[model samples]
Target: MAVRMLINGVAADQVPALDRGLAYGDGLFESIRLVDAVAPLWSRHMRRLVESCGRLRIPPPDTMQLWSEVLEVTRDMPHSVVRITVTRGIGERGYALPAAPQPMRVVAAFAPPQVADSAYAQGVRMRVCDIRLAEQPLLAGMKHLNRLEQVLARAEWSDPAIAEGVLCDSHGRVISATMANLFAVVDGMLLTPALDRCGVAGVARAEVLAACPQTQVGALTLDALLGASEVFLSSSVRGILPVRSLDKQDYPVGGTTRQLQQHWRDLGLRWSRADE
Candidate 1:
């Protein structure tokens, strides 16, 4: 089967054109990886989604109802990706807010992408994107609807060999990968970029931080990243993917990266070849 979708608890494939999310990108979403028919980091995803809703002033959906809808759509699927979207329902002609706004809830499930076993066992190659992320403090760290930056950065490459792309902010500070969070092992210290200026704070990134409490979150420059002994990317869908090379720079799969992969398995979110 292909992708199954539901809109506002109904079996539908599309939303009305006037929906605020369609008109103005006014909404929040969470992409969760379901393994063995369960979402391992569901609570973390929910927390972020609720926080983002609060930030955007979009009334949060009922947690229980949302989960039920997710389960309903993903039922019988052993491995899949479930995306939950909450949008401000159909609105008036302008940017003005509706006095009694109704929120739309969408739950969809798709077959997970088939990643080669080698891509996980032996690190994957990446590239440095020419496009840079804009610094927006107001929208930083939240997975909001506007994603033109990521769309453009991802369009920079179409080569199948490059597993991901490293994206930096306007000031040359490394923020994250096109679809994941960035992390590096520098001189025995674990470091990840601070998302205050920009970037989505991924759920897998939070798991890494929790596993390694000593992780330093701060500004990470391109020089700092290239100089690191090990580099890895994390996302809710693909857990920890060590970077074998970025552009012409080479990186080893190293002990630190493997250890972190183990940490992910310990958290009961196992899908990587490293777990095998």
Candidate 2:
């Protein structure tokens, strides 16, 4: 639990009570994986953060400054996770945003996933929750601070055996997993659900699409997901994770998953390593 948390480049314990991020969840966050004290996905995280800030109308922090803080807070750590949160600073009592809102940035570091390599090679089991994501076109792909949907969906099950939960839209179209982007291989084509209506567009998903130009993004149904030849989850920290089983049905960690994992490793995203 030896970690350092900084608020606006200085050591601090808490944010202002009137901060809009705490008041109305007016904020954005990026979880960066620091492998060997390096963040290979820093550019991707910065791109998404800038996009989210523009979408949310919050001012984006200086990319170089943010990187400096990332390294500053996570110094000397061999393997860790650095989470950067940008808030709309303190605001008035009403819903109206300030005309000149100053954004507050918080950087904190913690231990990375401790799951064994077997979890990635053999695949992890996930569950489908009853809670459906309400379509919000405006907030569709932004990783804003509001995560009550994922919180409640994750709360739907407490089985330690379940590594993650797949979420769908109100119309039963699969979107993504609770913490990672979902991907499936169907008819020898890589497919992932379109996130124009819901779900966060994870950084790792962006990388996969960039590397595998043949990948397609569209609506994915639960039946379609179950019918796929292979399934996996992508995230900044974990890289790629094959899905072994979805509830009662079983899926092997097929070649497609291995190929994508190898691609990530070749790209020098050290977090891609499934082994410690």
Candidate 3:
């Protein structure tokens, strides 16, 4: 089925070419999964989007109106990936904020790619990306429009066998993956990097931390990662994916990892069913 898009409650085709989002990367976006006509993590995504807009000084659209637009765009789609983007609207040719700012909101729906359930069951292989994430505390956790870093890291490998890349911060401290948050089991405790310097605080990462309050968040070095008993990556789209190896250093999917995976699946199923 063809994807559908809406801009400010109108057909996406009506969007003006002068939209700032197309000219400059002055926007925030959310990639959410719509199951049974409901976006399970809609609230969480909206909260983060609003926070990102506040940080970027972009005026936020009304939440109720935005939700209405999302429903309008996805009304005919059952299971899909929903993308919501908000930009600073049309502006003069300058970096300065427009004298009278009007935000533009775009909501679109696309078929989500088919993922192998076994990948989550058996775990996935990962490589340590040589490309280090530059420390930008201001953009640390928001899903902003700038993503050249991830694009560069992902381009480093074309081998289909490798599923993801583990990234480190500019200071050589392990941060996360190109598209997900990293968690490891060290000394029988779950450890994830502190995202103060870099990395996105993924929705799945937040869920895992909420589910397991004892999970530790702190600075992690490559040495600690190499010596860890097990590792995994988390994202809203991928859920919890165990890391079978890092940079050819192998480790079995630990018991704790599996336990968390099961918990995550249960939560996901519940969320999906709740939308029914």
TM-score of 3: 0.91
Model 2 lDDT per residue over 177-264, tens place: 9999999998888999999988999999998898788999998999989988899999998889899999888997888788888887
Better of 2 and 3 by lDDT: 2
Given candidate 2, what's the lDDT at residue 261? 86
Query: Over the full model, what C-alpha lDDT does candidate 1 score relative to the true structure?
Result: 0.89
Instruction: Supply candidate 1's per-residue lDDT for 98.
Output: 81
Q: Against the true structure, what is each candidate's TM-score?
A: 0.97, 0.97, 0.91
| TM-score result, candidate 1 | 0.97
lDDT of 1 by residue, 143-212 (tens): 9889998999999989999989999999999999999998999988999999997999999899889888
Residue-level lDDT tens digits of model 3 in 127-167 = 88989999989988888787888999999999988999988
Which model, 1 or 2, shows the larger lDDT? Answer: 2
Residue 20 local lDDT, model 3: 77
lDDT of all predictions:
0.89, 0.89, 0.81
Clashing pairs in 1: none
